[model samples]
Target chain A: MIETTVFAMQVLLLVMGCLFFAVGTLGLFRFSDTLSRIHALTKVDNLGLGFIVLALLPLAPSLAGGLKTVLIWAAALAASATSAHLIARAVHVRPEPPEAKESADD
Target chain B: MTLILNAVAAFLLLTLLIALIRIWRGPAPADRMLASQLFGTTGVALLLLLAHAQAMPALMDVALTLAVLSVLAIVAFVTRVVRIDRPSSGRKAGDQPETHHD
Candidate 1:
């Protein structure tokens, strides 16, 4: 019974993770500008990956395996945050060409 | 459970393909890079799921490596912009000096 319950929970988490990831992609499509899209992608990377990690923990073969998986999540979050900052800074430092229509968002 | 894992992994891949459309339609360079970041994050998740589905724990390491590498893509994109824009930025400083304000 306990194993079955865990499986159920895992399934739920996996679905949630995938859903948030889809939403982030939707933001990429619907948001008018690059900055807003960046905001949306970071959230999905953080939250969606977190949920997926949580769901996968139960499948780990050992404690070390679980720790390694969690570490991946931490590393991913760190990388995502750092990259988003760099990209946003780049966008700010060098606004798109003046003639470009999308740069008008600036 | 393996079936469900495979299904979810497929769903993630589908979303990834959808994101590719954004990459294609990018009106700004940053938008293209942002979609690239999306690919990195989603790829990590996909690898993790596949690791379990295939019962190959080593894929976990691949996922970790991907997680680390994804950041590099954005870093390169930013530095690439900054390197090319530095001289002009110095000139534009006078017209709109917003750098120090932040």
Candidate 2:
């Protein structure tokens, strides 16, 4: 019974994570603006990943393996955030048409 | 159970691919930044799923650190943009209304 229960939980987590990931991907294509897209991606992405992590936590073979996974997650987040910021900054500084530009450009 | 986890990981990878598309086609730097953020999120999700399947705990700590750092990066970017866009005090001497109206 205990084994079955654990298996069930794992399945549940997998489904939930997939759903959120799908939503995040859809948002990437659907949003009209960068800011809006970011908002959508962040919401779904964070929860999706978190759920997946929680689900897998039980299966970790050893403490070392678990810690390694967490470290990888941290590194991924750092890279993503920094790259995004740099790209956004570049966009903000470039010369562009008035209509396509942010109000702050004035 | 392993199959289910594998499927989830695959889906997350797909999400990452979509985000890459966005980054490639992004009209502006901001758009690219948004796409990159998506990548980060998906990457974390993938790592977590993998760890779970492998039964690893250390990966969770990494995910937590990533979450915090990503948020900080966003905040920093916003502040930097705001500072850059701030209006300068360059009022023309003539534009300063003539005080001789008295």
Candidate 3:
């Protein structure tokens, strides 16, 4: 019974994680500007990856493996947040030439 | 359970392909960069799922490496591609005008 329950939970998590990732990418297509796209990618993908990590934790072969798995999530989160900020800062410091009719809102 | 995991992985890959469309068509460099970051996250998730599905522990290490490498790539972009100019002719601007190798 316990094993069956765990399996069900894992399936649920995996499905949810994939959907969240899809939505994050959807944001990229919907949003018009660079900063908005970053906003979507960072926030939504964080949840998506977090769900996948949670699903994998129970199946980890050892305590160390589980920790390593969690560590990957942490490292990715740090990288995403830091890189998003840096990219935004870069865009702010040196504004790019606005392409013609590129942005939806003037 | 394995079937579900595979289905989920397939969906994630589908989303990745959708993201690539934006990467190709994005107006600004930052937009492309953000899409690539999405790729990194999706790739990591896919790696973890693959590790679990295939019973391969070593692949998790590969995920960790990819996570670390993605950050390094962003750092390189910010430092090299994004030009940083010291505020010209203000406080400390006179100290040493910023210079770019290229």
Candidate 4:
């Protein structure tokens, strides 16, 4: 039935989303530079989240629930985009960041 | 479907473990902050997966809040840690001519 097919697609999307998330995390280990790591984390992870959200849409409890699900995706995307730019800008402003002077890192 | 969602959520946690390694090995402030960003985002996805798998609607609000807080964390790092305002004032005139503007 069509419902079965949709279910299968959802499962596939969910698995693929997890794979993308893993790949994004992999960038942190593989890339030595901070900006390069950010490049991988921000862009790929958003794609991963998008896939996961798509998979979950069919399971939403109601129309309101579904819209809220989509809204989460939108908010995450905006956050990632803005933070990526901000982090990149921060890096640009200071090629060398002082990690030792701050307590936040500890 | 619920089983698969739970499995996917578990997989995301593994990714978070990898990001933790990045944090442990960071040589720059941005690198560490980036690891935390990964944490925030991965946490969001994990919450969503659980919300569906466990049939809990309130977790969605939690995810939204997490997203907002994560971005705010980045902003804090920029303003307080990296101190974004310093570049314009700290440098001498005609030093690194390309950098001093805005």
Candidate 5:
């Protein structure tokens, strides 16, 4: 019974992670602005990868291996947050009209 | 378990494809940069999933490298593209108050 329970949990977590990733990508299409798109990608993808990392921990071959996996997740979070901030600051310092924007009137 | 992991990885790949669309149709450079960041995150996640699915621990190391270095690309973009508007001599015009020459 416990094995089946764990299996179900893993499936659910993985599925949830994938869904979050999809939503993050969808934000790129739906949001009209760069900052908003960064907001979606950073925040949502962080959660998505975190879930996947958590799901994989139980399957790790050793304690060190598990910690390594977590480290990957932490590193990714840092990279995402830092890059997002840099991009947003760059945009703020010099706002540019998008090169191929569509008319808002329609 | 392997099957489930493969399916999840495939879905993440789909997400990656959608993000690629944004990069390709970028209305702005920042938009493309943000999409590239998304790609980096997705790549790391896919690497992790691959490690588990294939029982190859070394893939985690590749993921680590990817996660750590992905930000460098954006930093380069910011320094190179965003700051190109002005001279790179470490000063912007009118940044200091003018004083009469003696």
Candidate 6:
């Protein structure tokens, strides 16, 4: 009974994670602006990944496998944050329009 | 148990697809960067799921490396922006008129 219950929980978590991921993707496609897309992608992606990882923990075959799973989760979180920051910075430094340049000179 | 993992993996794959769209159609460099970040996150998640399914411990190293590299890339990009925005030495090449010693 306990094993069955655990399996059910894992399945539930996985389904929820997938649902979140799907919604996040939809948000990306629906949003008009980059910032809005980022907002959707970051929040949903992070939570979705976290839940998926959590679901996998119980199924890990060995102690080492479990440890590794946790480590990957940690890494994902760090990488996601940094990558978002870089992308945002790149957008901010783009060249200004010709009209804006002319106005500045005037 | 395996069913759950499979479902989650499938979802992660979908997320990756969305991120790819963002990377390709993003309006600005920052947007692309954000997409890439999403890719990194999804990649790590996928790796974790795979490791669990396959019972492999070595794959975690790949995720760690990816995480570190992503951060390094962000730092480099930020520094580049700062350098570009800094004042350009505050002196012009053709400023002889302003240097009169009389």
Candidates 3 and 4 compared: the better one by TM-score is 4
What is every candidate's C-alpha DockQ against the true complex, given to 2 decimals?
A: 0.50, 0.29, 0.50, 0.63, 0.45, 0.35
Flag the better candidate by lDDT, 3 or 6: 3
Supply the global lDDT for candidate 2: 0.63
Alpha-carbon shift of residue B93 in model 3 (angstroms): 6.1
TM-score of 4: 0.89
Give the fraction of reference interface contacts each candidate recovers.
0.70, 0.59, 0.74, 0.71, 0.78, 0.67
Q: Which candidate has the highest TM-score of all?
A: 4
Residue-by-residue lDDT tens digits, candidate 1, A31-94 = 8987888898898757998999899999999999999999988888888887788788777766
Off by over 4 Å in 1: A97-106, B82-102
How does each model score on TM-score?
A: 0.86, 0.62, 0.85, 0.89, 0.86, 0.73
Tell me how far the alpha carbon of residue B46 in candidate 6 is from the true structure, in angstroms, after superposition.
1.0
Q: Is candidate 1 or candidate 3 better by TM-score?
A: 1
Range of the 10 consecutive residues with the lowest summed lDDT in candidate 2 chain A: A93-102
Which residue pairs show backbone clashes in model 6?
Answer: A87-B30, A91-B30
Scored against the true structure, residue B4 in model 4 reaches a CA lDDT of: 91
Q: By DockQ thresholds, what CAPRI class is model 6?
A: acceptable
Candidate 4 clashing pairs? none
Candidate 2 segments whose C-alpha is farther than 4 A from its true place: A62-106, B51-102
State residue A79's C-alpha deviation in candidate 2, in Å.
8.6
Q: TM-score (chain A) of candidate 2?
A: 0.73
Tell me which of candidates 3 and 6 scores higher on DockQ. Answer: 3
Give the per-residue lDDT digits (tens) of candidate 5, residues B1-102: 998898888889988987898777876677777765875689999999999898888899999988877888887877766663454445666675233378
**Residue B22 accuracy (lDDT) in model 4:** 70
i-RMSD values for every candidate model: 2.8, 5.7, 3.3, 1.3, 3.6, 4.6
lDDT, residue A27, model 1: 86
Cand. 2 TM to true fold:
0.62
* Alpha-carbon runs more than 4 Å astray in model 3: A97-106, B85-102
**Better candidate by DockQ, 1 or 4:** 4
